[model samples]
Target: MKLHTPKTLPYIPVAPGALPILGHFAKMKNNQVAFLEETQKKLGPLFWLNAGFGQWTVVVTGEAAHTVMKNKETRSDVMGGEGDRITGHITTDTVSIKDGAPHRRIRGAIQSPFTPKGLTVSEIGALLEETAEKRTSGWKENTKLEILHETSVYALDIIFRMLGVADLDLPLWRKTYNDFVGPWTMIPFNFPGSPRWRSLKARDWMDKEFQKMIDQARATGDTKTMLGAIVHGTDEEGQGLEPKELFANLRILGLAGHETTAATVAWMFIHMGATPELWEEIREEAVAADSPPTSPKDMERFPKIEALFREVLRLYPVINVLTPRRVEEPIEIYGVKIPKDTSVSASLLSLSRDANLYPNPETLSLERWTKQAHRPKPSEAVQFGGGPHFCLGYHLAVFEGVVYTTIAARRLASLGLQPVLQGEIPKPTYMPLTRPPAEAKILLKPNYKA
Candidate 1:
């Protein structure tokens, strides 16, 4: 493999502070976004900052972001090296950190479960109904609830069942998974028996469980479900995936399928709750459609509802920062040549909020999407990311989003439910790192019955 060498680019300097050894570690340890924004204000979009030691991080936005995310030459090297420091905390051999042919093979193996052709439409509809029923039971009249945790549980349960991990230990898995993966976003250290340590343990447990599942499936001679497919799948050489690779890929698909979708669903409720008029409009639109609440085809036709979702992702993307990319070859970005081995990131938070791409970017407008809805192709929104590394489970995420939103909107419309926002939803403190607040609450009141 040809390695690109580092070349000096026009330097956009961040604020000069911190001791030589500490760098900006203190500020970053406290609040990453505040640190980034402070630097951006001081240094501009292409600024460089010292993360620690001699390590430097280049933060890019707007067109620069579009370039970084789509730059095939850069490869997803950061995910390979450092991502394991995070993802490995949850599960090992995750596809996110795998490269080249290995990545392709793992993703291909699991693709069937999420694709439209994979599951029968009737099966999907039934799953959605089961999920909605499970979710709606917790919602009370004029109640205040945190949607993220609820949606996460619903999504996890659905994914777990779909993957055929029905009898696995739930509480132990949840605690271990969260403990290991969650902290990695905030800090990279892994002390023994710590959350990271426990995460490792959980991962090992999952690995054994996955192997047992595969073994049982092999014994039964079934390749119908996702777990069975992975176990029974063969490469061009006609060899099945090794135990480690199978476990890793399964963990990656399972966790990625749930976490990001749950976060986006949380953001959806927060957005809808904050905007009463838009919420009511969506409610009315869903009620007017009068189709089965969980039908994907009918959900696809609800432009306003779709627009509302698009706008929410625009304002508050779930994965705020694109995982780091390493330059594989020399590339010019905004007239500066970035050499190989340079660590770079695209801020989806900054890109989605760009005023040029999104006029009056701070204000939420559902119609903005509706007016441009006729355009053929994906929107500029990088919430699902772009290029080869784009989310494999994109359709599944959208399916859940549509189903959950449709159910909420229809219920609210029928009872004329109005959500009373208490205060501003908390911004992510760790840039793209943190999850929705555990205590964040929204109150709902039913007014006019449809």
Candidate 2:
């Protein structure tokens, strides 16, 4: 499969600035979003880089990315593994690591709760509001809040509740859950009082909790929560997940679903600070509606706010690069020939920032989507991702945003979000995922309910 490129066909080119051993790792670490954008103009979309050692990462953009998403020659197992480092959970058949029929089976079995006709939006909405209230109860006049930390817990609470944790256990569950997943980037050395040690302990706590949820659902024949969906839902062939598959996938849902939604909402809050007028826009979403959205079904009532959120995703995408896909067979795309056994990933940032796909791509304008004629092709924001492996929680994420902002708008009628430093908003960090600065602060004040 390593045949030399035909004289007629060009091999994929390497992006500039590959420092000896570090390759493009150093440059990407500094600012990957900018690096990809700048490189796209100079290198022409698709390029390869050595992250380190002999490992090669192929970066695809535009048409190439769309092709990769829909192609069978690529598989997702190249990125995530059977044992997840981030979650510290291991499962041989987790959907993210499996492909072909097994992947389909696992994905199908768990997908019902997220599907349009199956999810109970009202219940989820009620839970979301309850969680939001507790998380934001600290918000008072001139209160300084770190958007990322708040949104992370807010999103985590929603996920846990959906998986059947009782409201009373939410506070402790959240703390344990955070400790469980927080060691992904830390140095890996197992010792007492270490992050890894805490994570392992957290994992043990999660295992017991998940097993209880599974047992209760199995015993009661209940299908109300996501845990039940995995236990009872069937695939196309009418097969359900095995106990191992069910538990493994259930453990992964929090890690998989929480981050994207949290990062997106956090970015939205940053926008709320930069453009205080948007608060009225958010308020109007709830006001103009016949009634407030008590369920995901009511998201349609808030098109203006929906458009605003879509634009935020485009300008500030939560996914900088889709999980890298490994090429399984030789293929040619976009006039470039890709060899087998190579690591390739689609760049969501490239597609989002493409001027051809979006006019004035850098600017945030709702009309880009709200206006029928101005909407770009492949309309839904690609930030959630594309292809067969597109985000499983895409629908839930969208509805959650609509539900959250509407509730916030109505509750904090006088609330205003202003930069804590009172100047131009800083650029978001873009590695692992795109998110607002951890140190970024906002002043919330005079939010007397109307």
Candidate 3:
């Protein structure tokens, strides 16, 4: 399992502006996309920076990224747990963040529910379509709606319903969800009024809520909802999740499930608004479909819409970087030996836009995915990441995105409405997940229908 490395060069190149102790935290916080791109241009594919705690080596693009993602020695669990502070308080054994055998066992136990076969595509699609209609029903002509907030709320509501908790205090949960994620990228501090403080308070509330649901599901033997499945599921060893493990895993699902999809869907609207011709074609495809994509089989009807969804993920990856890891065992990649405990991350943002892999990388061209000649290699588009730890919810996210966007697009067209950008387009916030700014608006404008 050893990778060959150059005898002379032991470590990767370090990017400039290493401040005492704090490192490049300030620069990254200011504008992550710009900073990473700039550094890559200067330092080539792989470079290191100290994000305050320790030096982190980032694989920007090309073979280096593939090398890092494929290497099993670069274990994911060493950095932070799937739920971080929130879920960590409950248990660190959630499948999403675990490495090695434990990860396999937990993943095996939890994986079935998310598999393509396990999901009832038509049922999920129908539910999402209904949700989308309700969300868009209130929109009026010429009104400005913040795309991120609107999409976030829409996604949150749909996910809650899918979790079989639609009756929960959604408004309160929404507030809590925001607070829980608010401090993800901020420096950890727990004083009153701080993001960390508020997040902890939010986590406390959520922990209790999920625990109650778990207890109820166990008591009632309700195997219908996701929680019910997990509560009842067992691994290859016939071992079930402990109460803490179950609670933590559920929290991971709650946070990771909703936020990333919400961000991507918000960006999808922005891309659609920016490209009207493509939007029209997609809408027409949705309208001309044999029937709305109630099932995965029916999804084949909108190939163009599916292509557009892939393009959106490439351009704006919600989880820009997979969870970075502290290399517990030394690993060599790109002729450099990464020492033990050195933080290493594969930059999905950089890899998706590599000109070598994607021609005219900056352009939002759906043809790259649609056209056989232009499509990237499997390794190039690591938007959901690579290796054994690739996003568990990848399929579900795509299904939800395609189902929600296709139906929503048709509805918008029927109402003689189209998305129009309001003011200057705001840059995405670079947090644990990339999100469009809160003020990012898409106005519903009257479009003269043919």
Candidate 4:
């Protein structure tokens, strides 16, 4: 496959203080948000930065984000050699990552399950309620547990149930998921102990497990779960996903369904812990609803909970930036000409925090979402992104967030427990997806429920 394109418009301008060989890799690893913010401040909305092996043009504004996310010219399929290697090892044929006809076909087959119409609200709510109750109860009142780790486990259970893999080991599945996805943003290192090495091994284990489930689903003609849906699904053309395609796309669903949602749930906890009033609001809403939300459609009934989730996404997008898009032909973003095959991406993190669009952007204002007039304009708070490639599990993720957050908040409140931050706010790991810092612990305080 072709790797190089004709030289792009004089490369997008690089951020200042980029070291010669390593470039901005260190800064990127150290703190991606601050690095991108500083660069955007100095270089304006669209600029380039050296990220170890090469340079990538970063787009920050809604307009530029729209340009890159929507333009079919900037296709969303895999890059040549490296992309092949990564997808080959981890995700072989994910529909969302595909660019052309294959993407559309595969996406069509899988899209139904994620849409509001297809999702079984009772099943989703039951799984989330079960998982949250089981996991949080394990944490004794007033104890501290790493929110990310706990939520990851919770997300895994809910997603696995969605895939009809309810019999799998939760802890092992969670670890494998983490290992496989941890290296997506790491420097390409193939050493025995490297992140890439661990990731590949983890993917192999997880792939075999999913393969077994797929085989069973096909054998049994089980159409209840997503895996069963894909196993027996067809596109408008009556083309079904091939086995390899099935494996890859299922892997994508598993990864995307859980990891990002887990991160969002974790951040929701962090934010709620900091603002007790928000948790109170969520609890009050839950009480008024008379029952916990059980499905994506049911979540619509809980506007306050939905609003809080929206605010959390706006403040801490699980994906700080949309997937990178390589220009197929020359394109102009913010009047700056980016030449053919130039690697480009848009930072959703930056856009969500745009003060011009979201006044007092840094503050966590749940009211901004609840009060119709204060909500961001379309594409302004791009938590799930926009255009053709917006997050496939957008609705499912929101439902999961509302269910998990509402349950957890109520559980804590019932225990007379309040969420309190024990240390400095964690700096998120902003690659692959934005993950909360493990060290940013939350402690439960008793008897402050108002």
Candidate 5:
């Protein structure tokens, strides 16, 4: 689709820096959020930036961000072409790289298990209980534990059960999955026998494992699980998904599901530890609700807990950048015209913390969401994104967040955990990525119920 170029020209110039060849790569690499914020401050809401070669990326604001995410004409090109160039290196079927009909078809097939309404709460509660028991089972008094590692493992287990792959060796699977996804966020260089290479090896292993499960499900006539649903599901043409497509869907589901949720949950715990007042409030709510400890249905009553999760997401979104899209037609956003085929991305991390939208954006206030008088509409927060490509797993993510946070809050309150105030948690070594701290520790003592 060719975009109409206006005679008056709407293209906004990016703030100038760097030599001809280097461009803004250095600034982006050093600290992506700060660099972008600095650029936005100087260049205004929508500005362009050189990101290698002749490619220019348009960084947009929150208002324009809503439009960009909802613009159907501006196709999600990242799922194909350039998206594939990067994601395909790790797994050939990475769902983020698939576009158009294929993307829709695959998403439909995989969404079957999630169709069982109200299952998320129950499932997540079960998983959280299992994780809590396992984590505290080995805890010794005064011993420091890395919550990030523990939570990462817990998140993976939850995802595995949700995907109907619970029987696999978790430690080995965790190691392999981490190795596979770890390098994808880094610069697109692959070294011989490096971590990236090992990740590729892991991807191959995962592909085979998924394929084996698919074959087993088909042979055994098991259509009860998500994996089975995908394997057995037929398209409009009444044909089952090809092995490659099935593997691609599973690859994306497995990788995306575990990593993002794990990071967010770990961050949530860290924030709770830092702010004990919020933690106590959550514990009191959960206890006063008098709801069955393990019941998912009862947990939904705690909107404060849910709000706390949203606050954390606002501060540290798991996927800091929105999925990139290419303009198919000339579109004006915040008075700036973007030409056809221009690449653009919404800075979700920046937007969520925009002082204009969120007052006192840096503070961790769980009640911010409860103050309906000050709350923005649901669409204001793009944590799960907007429009057609919005996260299919959003409800599931929220359910898990509520379950894990509620359980953790209750347990911590009961134990009278006194969090150590430290500097900011470890930032990702790679830009625009979510990596947990090297060691995330919290202290616990007996609670004096007030």
Candidate 6:
């Protein structure tokens, strides 16, 4: 494959804090958000920062960020060579990361479960409410819990059930999956029992397990679960998922489907806990009250609940940076040429915080979304990357968040309760996905009925 384009156009401005082989590593590791924010203030939207080992990371802010995300010449299929190498190319064919025709085919074949028809099924809605109720069922005064950890359990349960894999060992599944995804494995080493070695081993084990599910579904013609849908569904051209494609995509889909939603819900808890009065207002709008959602249409029935999730997603996007996009051939954005095989990404956080896109960007206001009765198209969704590669699971994620929040709020309201968060407001994790800090805790406080 061609690795570079002819140097016919002037290069994008390069940020200047290189320190030999270390590059910008010192400034970026711990203080990335502050570093990027300050750089964007001075560098104006788009610039390249050296990331050592001959790599240049393209960082774009504001409108140019959206341009890169939507540009057809830019490919989201590649992150870096090492991201896929350790897991035997586990994500090489994932629908969310593939480009062009392959992406279209896999996305079409596997998206049955995320569509309105798929989610509108009465059982699916009931399942979400049941799961939400399960998560909030045991909370009591003085309860000590990490919000992120709690939401993660809820999200994983939902995605696994949807995939018909709930019978598997979920805690073990997440741990193994985490091993495969941990950043430390990016070291490119594969010694036995090392993180990279364990990641590869986990992928192999997970693949065998998924293949068995696929085999059973195809034999029985099972069509109830999301896994079954992918097995039976076809693309517009009547193409079906190849085995490796199915395995790879299922793995990424499970991770993407649950983890991001979990992180977003954790933020929802933090915000809602801080504002007890808002919970009363939100609970009043939850027509379901003490029960789970009754039907697929119930997804849209709770306006305040939906807006609460929307505002939380906007203020604290779980995926701050869209996964790396690889430039294909030559592409120009804001008059700067990005050559073939160049890796870049857009900052969802920056775009979400842009004053032009969101007024009072730092403040939380349900009015920003509720007044407009906003349901954003994927192409314009700021928190979820906008464009062809926009998150395919947006509806499912939102449904899960809305259902959980509504149930939790309504359940608390029924008991004359509100969550009073303990400890200082938690800060975002220093990781790429901005989950609420694991130590942040919440406890019950009394508030009158909805």
Which predicted model would earn the best lDDT?
A: 6
Please identify model 2 stretches exceeding 4 Å from their true place: 1-11, 16-26, 50-55, 82-92, 183-198, 373-379, 414-422, 446-450
TM accuracy, model 5:
0.84
Worst 10 residues of 3 by lDDT: 1-10
lDDT of 3: 0.70
Residue-level error in angstroms, candidate 6, position 247 = 0.6
The CA lDDT of each predicted structure is 0.65, 0.71, 0.70, 0.71, 0.64, 0.73
Q: What digit string (tens of lDDT, one per residue) describes model 2 on residues 1-450?
A: 231222222467778888865667678767777888888889887777554433467788886787677648887666444344432244345787677888888888889888645566326766776777677666666778777787787788898888888888988988887786663423346789888788778877887888888888889998776677768988999999887777678777887777778777776767777776665566666666654556656666777677777888888788777766777887787876787767787888888888898889888776776675543333366887776777788777877777776666665553543223335666767545677767777676653233
Model 5 lDDT at residue 389: 67
**Model 5 per-residue lDDT tens digits across residues 1-450:** 222221223456565674465566666655555666677878788777655433456767766787777756576754444345445554455445556676666666666555425354234456556665665555443545576776677777776665566545777777777787774433455678776677778878988877777778889887665566667876565656667777766767766666677677777767756666766677777666554235434545777887887887787776666756787777888866677777777777667888897899988776677876653444755877877667766666666667676666555555555344255655542233544554666655444343
- Report the C-alpha displacement of residue 96, candidate 2, in angstroms: 1.6
- lDDT by residue for model 1 over 1-450, one digit each (tens)? 222212254454554565575566666556555566566667677766555544455767667787777757676656433344434344346666556787677666666655655554326656766667667755656878777777777677767666676635555556655654564433455678566666667677777777787789889987777667667776554656667777767776656777777777777787777776767787777777765345444455677776776777777676666777778777777777677777777877777777887899888888787787363134455877776677777666776777777777666655556665568976643323434665566777775443
Q: Indicate whether candidate 3 or candidate 5 has the larger TM-score.
A: 3
Ranking by TM-score: 4, 6, 3, 2, 1, 5
Q: 380 in model 1: Cα distance from truth in Å?
A: 3.8
Candidate 2 lDDT: 0.71
- Determine the backbone clash count of candidate 4: 1
- Tell how far residue 279 is off in model 2, in angstroms: 2.8
- Clash pairs, model 2 backbone: none
TM-score of 4: 0.90
Question: Candidates' TM-scores?
Answer: 0.84, 0.87, 0.88, 0.90, 0.84, 0.89
What does candidate 2 score on TM? Answer: 0.87
Worst 10 residues of 1 by lDDT: 1-10
Flag clash pairs in model 1: none
List model 6 lDDT by residue over 1-450, tens digit each.
233311322366666576766566556655555667788888877767655544456777777777678757787755522355433344576776677788789988988778767877425787887778877898765666688889988898887677777635777777777776766665567799888888788889888888888899999998777778888878899999998788888888766877789888888778778876776667677745545555545655676777778888887777776766777767676777677787777888798888887889888887776677455555556788888877888878888888888788777766777777777667666454667777787777776442
In model 4, which regions exceed 4 Å deviation? 1-8, 20-22, 58-60, 78-88, 184-194, 373-381
Backbone atom clashes (below 3 Å) for every candidate = 0, 0, 1, 1, 1, 0
